[model samples]
Every structure is written in C-alpha cells, then in structure tokens.
Target: MRAVACVLFILSLVWDSVRADNSISSLKMAAASWEGELPCKEWNCECAFKQRGCCCAATDLQEVEDQIFHKVMDLSRRVFQLGDTILEVLGGIRVAFTASMSHKKTCFGPFTRSTPIPYNLLTFNHGSGYNPALGIFTAPRPGLYSFSFSVYSKVQGEGEKMYYKVQLMRNGEAVVSTWEDNREDSEDSSSQTVLLSLEQGGQVYVQLLSGRQLCGNIEGLNTFSGALIYPTLT
Candidate 1:
C-alpha cells in the first residue's frame, strides 16, 4: 500500500509540472503575437490566455460564418425571384378569342382613309386579350399565334361595284389582304389565316383600306379569331 501511494504522488507531481510548462508556453506565444496590444481590442472575440491567439481564431471563425450566411441569403432571394417568374409564365396558359361585327344589316365603310374594323361581338375571349372597344387583340405573352379573318360584301345591282379591300394588321402594319373589286358576283366573302410569332403587348386587328366598302348582311360574316399555340418565354 505504501509503494502504491508513493507511485501516485510521483505521478501527480509530474502532471503538475507538465501543466505548468504548457501554461507558460501558451502565455509566451500570446505575448509574442500581441506584444504591445490589448487582448481582443480590435476584434469581437472572447479573450483567452490558455491558447495562443485564441481570440483572433474565434474572430476569424465568426467572419467566415458571416460570409457564408450572406451568401445563403443572396441565393434564397434568387430562388424566390425565379419562382415568381415561373408563376407569371404559367398564368397565361391558353389564350384564344373569336369576335365578329354586331348583328345587323349595315354598311361598314367607303372611308377617305384606312380604318380599323371594330368586331364588337365577342363569341369567346379566353384570356381577355381582345378589346372590342379598341378593335384590337393585344398579346398577353410572347408566343406563336394563329390569326384568321373573313370579309364579306354585297351590292344591290349586278353592274354595281362590289369593291372591298380588307387587311389583317399587326401593330399598324399590314400583313395580309383580301379584295374583290369585280361586279361578277353581287356578293362575296374572302378569308385569310396567318401564323405569327409575337412578343408580349403586340397588337393585331382587321382593317379596311381606303375607298372600299362592305355593304349588306355583314354581321357574323365578318369575323376575326386568334389562338396561342405555345409560349416563347424568351
């Protein structure tokens, strides 16, 4: 029992001496690194003398963590922006409309200048892009669209002029035209269909050229229709 106690006492002394040496070495290193500066004076850090530059180590770790946190926040903001763009694209899925002149036995025009035709009857307006008042169909999104229009006119006499010139227009520019100036037929109708790639807010409509007239039962016979094939998100 006495020999065991002696061994334990010697072990305790050796451990104390080692601990004292480690503590002195740590203090020396700290003093050498910050010779004339106050501990943690220039940094948000916990000061410690038990390990060399422990305060600076903590401050560097905090700076790295802050950088990582800022990067995460920026990525999150980008993700939300992408999600909003996707929702907006999906919002205008299927767009289509069919419109015609009001139900009446009337005459359209033999105007001095070119005029846009107001197809005021709305048979279908899936996306509400067509404006009966404005006589235009504005594209709600960029896409490939198919547009069709028909023109009809009738004259009282066989020798009378059945003159009519109708055009499909895109943003004030004429795309396609149909006309019948001969008196061979007392009444006639012509239709045109076109496929157009359009950007958002692009406008399309039917227009009558100058010095032309559409007279007679030209109600539902004069028609304009369009449908979106697919979106081009660019």
Candidate 2:
C-alpha cells in the first residue's frame, strides 16, 4: 500500500508541473500574438514565452515613441517652411517716397529763397497735393511695414512761421501724425516713425501749414522730407 501511494503521489506532482508549464506556454503565446511574431512551438515553449513577452513590451514602447517623434518633426518642418516663405515675400514689397521743395514764394518780404530745397530731410510725394480731410496712405502690398518722416522749417516771427505736419496713413486712416511749430524765430525740426500692417494699394501723404509773416528772416524758408516703407519681422 505504501509503494502504491508513493507512485500515485509522484504522478500527481508530475501532472501539476505539466499543468503549470501549459499555463506559462499559453501566456507566452498570447504575448507573441501581441508582438506580431511567430507562435511558440511545443518543444521550445520556454524560450518562446520569454522572448515573446520581452519583444511585445519593447515593441509597444518603441511604437509609441516613434509616433511622438514623427509628430514633432512634422510640426518643426512646417514652421521652418512658413518662416522661409514670409522672408521671401517681405523681400519683394518695400517702397519709399522722397519729397523736396521745388518752389518757394514770399508774399510781402525781400524773400531770397531758392527753388529745389536741399535734400536735408525725408518726405513723400503723393499723386495729388496733401489734403487734411484724407488721412491714410494705401499700401502697395500686404505686409508688415515701417513708416518714417522728417520735418524741416524756418522760424519767422511770432505769427509768421512755417508749420509742417507728418502723418502715417493706411487705407485713408491716420495711424500716426506729428507737427512742428516754427513760429518763434528759432530753427525747428521734427520727425516721426511708426509701424503698420498694411494691405496692398494703400496710400500715404504729408501736409504743410504756413503761419503768418513775422519780423525775422523769412526769405529762403523751404523744407524737404520723405517717407520710407519697409518690411519688418515683427
């Protein structure tokens, strides 16, 4: 009876070991399927199980990391290409206008001014004379632009001086304006700079105002100035 019991006990132990092995083998096969690899053979179950578990885990992680890397690379490339395109467009659409006095006249003084005033400052020339009612300059292209102007004037008397006004306009709207009052028998100069986002076919203009004559040297009192437009990164 004891011998028979020993044999049965040994058989039970073997059966349990086989069952545990079968469970491990089934788990490894499932893992292998997840990894898209070949299934384990019955004879090489141990090695296949180990390899499938490790390969499936590593492959999942690698796929996630690769997806993230590709997304980031695509975004970076798009931004770089957009920057290049903006630079190319800006390089093509800058415009500038310079203004100089071509004629000067005095009503009731020994005025001794010369025509074609010196190019001592900056200015702009529109198709028509400057009108205060119209305030903006249209752009020739849609872009980021900068505007600048300078005013040159001669001081006459308390009432008789030259007043010059500089303005930045976009689509007939005044974005900025500056004025110089030179009525105090002293030389006067003023300037202004502005940044604007302008559309194509916009216009800009400058206006001048003259004060009454005074008791100073009003003769040779003319001015020159202009506007420059260029593209900017900001």
The estimated TM-scores of all candidates read 0.60, 0.36
Clashing pairs in 1: none
Minimal lDDT window, size 10, model 1: 37-46
Residues 126-158, candidate 1: write the lDDT tens digits.
889899997899998899999999988899666
Candidate 2 local lDDT, 1-234, one digit each (tens): 332333234334345445656564554454334422232222233443355333223445678799999999999999999999997775455354444333334322222321111332234444222222333344545556556555545544456655445444445455666665555545555567676665555555543323322222323233322233544342
- Give the runs in model 1 whose Cα sits over 4 Å from its true position: 1-91
Q: Could you say which candidate leads in TM-score?
A: 1
> On a 0 to 1 TM-score scale, where does candidate 1 land against the true structure?
0.60
**C-alpha RMSD of each candidate structure in angstroms:** 13.3, 13.0
